[model samples]
Target: MTEETNGAAEPKAAAAPSQPVMQVLAQFVRDLSFENIVAQKGITNAAQPDVQVQVNLDAKKRSVENQYEVIMKLKVVSNIKDTQDPMFLMELEYGGIFHIQNVPDEQMHPFLLIECPRMLFPYVRRIVGDVTRDGGFPPLNLETIDFLALYRSELQRRAQAEAAAQTTPAS
Candidate 1:
């Protein structure tokens, strides 16, 4: 109340250092599709059954100021025994959005993209397996995914493609 200690004259306290906030704001399967391309009786009546599966994972970031929406997309295709037609085709794109307002600079990159998806992936994977089982097929047990390895492989693939394109003769 005194003139010597005006409200604005008080020394401000130093801000508390930023700390990581671990959270999954939302998680969901954004897209899912199942296509049985060979429903024809002749194709389904093959003498032997063999299955081939192709799996893929993809990710993208949607940034809005201080927050981000990270998506992990998974695709699977299965070919039935003795037929070229796909017996099952499933694609799922799941995502989580996080409000990481006060996260420190050093940890932000890993937290928003890596850790969030790491937390969300298992749930999504389970859903895929269960859905496949529910659809009257054997559960598709996916192997444990190495995200870092996958990312590296994709980068190498892109690099190789680019190099090949540059070396090819222009026709």
Candidate 2:
């Protein structure tokens, strides 16, 4: 065979796969409110109030290019279990701006909801603790969250809701 017909030059090795691109552009507290309902009494009273905490996650694509905003909404309410009087209330909406590239469309939802929130949780938790401590109550140290579990639960909930809607007659 002619030298031109043969593989005269060794073929170059295949290029390495590109790495997935994910980055956090910024993180901030969108909104925060801490209310001491009982004021001095709430602070001075030795009785400990039962504290209830609620957290919600939301995400949306920003108008800017390749950017998304994820928000963590946290609410804490404390009241004396015996008396039902409110001791304090705290609400915080913490947000993060993220830039994600090269992630598959199927993976984007989970990444935004689970991973973005996972990255932002520590800052939100710290602020909550600091505000509570500054508000005169003991520091409210939040426990670590299981984002994967939360994401799975949310998916299951949506699936059930859709199934129910399909079965029910529209009014």
Candidate 3:
């Protein structure tokens, strides 16, 4: 009798499966400040306002097992397009607590920074819109942020800064 046989080495597809788990425990606004500069200064302009937005992210492990906290910081500023008169300024910091499991150690940072904040963005977006509308301006709808790109930019920035620091002579 003849028997067909496959290779002795196990195929990679047959290896152990990896299933990462993530859950958002809680989310809230950590800090917020809004200034209606146009209203305060009694400035009026027909031109549309130019808006600038900045975002930063932070994450830390909690004492509880499989728990972590992630914070998203945003700063938004607006000005009259033609006259450059200040319109408004808003700074907000939103945070979330998460329970994560099964993610490898090497992947934890990206998972925390990217996925957690993505989950929190909608609520933060609503708060910003409400604040802007209530402050007497049109509701501000923020564009979707690409967290992966942001993460890569941060890494490149850090690497560049580290390289520059290494080359600079001590004062």
Candidate 4:
């Protein structure tokens, strides 16, 4: 047997890359306001008010390196179902500073909008509850939100709006 007959090839070596990293640098309440619109009268009233809540999310890159800020804006309005009188109004803009590294650009948008906010929801919910209770009403414990579903729905809505805008004739 001769060595020339052997067919094995030499293997090449390269450095192992680091995995992706994501961290919550800090979480805080950017803004919060509670209004007892009807004052003492609303609490004394026997009628239970219907509560309406709306949440909006937004994110932006920070001036510092590898850092981004995500804001979860929440609005809550309560009014008597049968009557036009308002009970209370609460608004909160909760925010977080996140440090993201090694994530692909394509995935960054969803990660920031959905994942970041998802991580911060519990704290925001607690604050809302406390604020309502302190304002002399029953605590408004907000339910857990599905950020992924919300993001998808927003995308669909934007697509429909763009399509509608394109179809309408300009005067």
Give the TM-scores of the predictions, in the order they appear. 0.65, 0.86, 0.88, 0.86
- For model 4, residues 1-171, the per-residue Cα lDDT tens digits are 656735677676775666778899999998999988877563554568899999999999999998999999999999988886888989999999999998788989999999999999999989998999898888889989999999999999999999999999999
Off by over 4 Å in 2: 1-9, 12-16, 40-44
lDDT of 4: 0.90
Report how far off residue 107 is in candidate 2 (Å): 0.5
Task: Write down the TM-score for model 4.
Answer: 0.86
> What's model 2's overall lDDT?
0.87
Clashing pairs in 1: 49-81, 50-81
Cα-based lDDT for every prediction: 0.66, 0.87, 0.93, 0.90
Residues 1-171 of candidate 1: C-alpha lDDT, one tens digit per residue: 655645577677998776766556677777887654444333452334344434344434455566677777777776655545567677778777766667777756556555666777788778878977775567767666666666567668989999999999999
| Ten contiguous residues minimizing lDDT sum, candidate 1 | 40-49
Off by over 4 Å in 1: 1-20, 36-64, 101-113, 162-171
What are the per-residue Cα lDDT tens digits for candidate 2 across 91-111? 999999999887777888899
On TM-score, the leading prediction is 3
In angstroms, what RMSD does candidate 2 have relative to the true structure? 3.2
| Window of ten residues with lowest summed lDDT in model 4 | 38-47
Cα-based lDDT at residue 156, candidate 3: 99
Residue 21 in candidate 3 has what lDDT? Answer: 87
Residue 91 in model 4: lDDT: 91
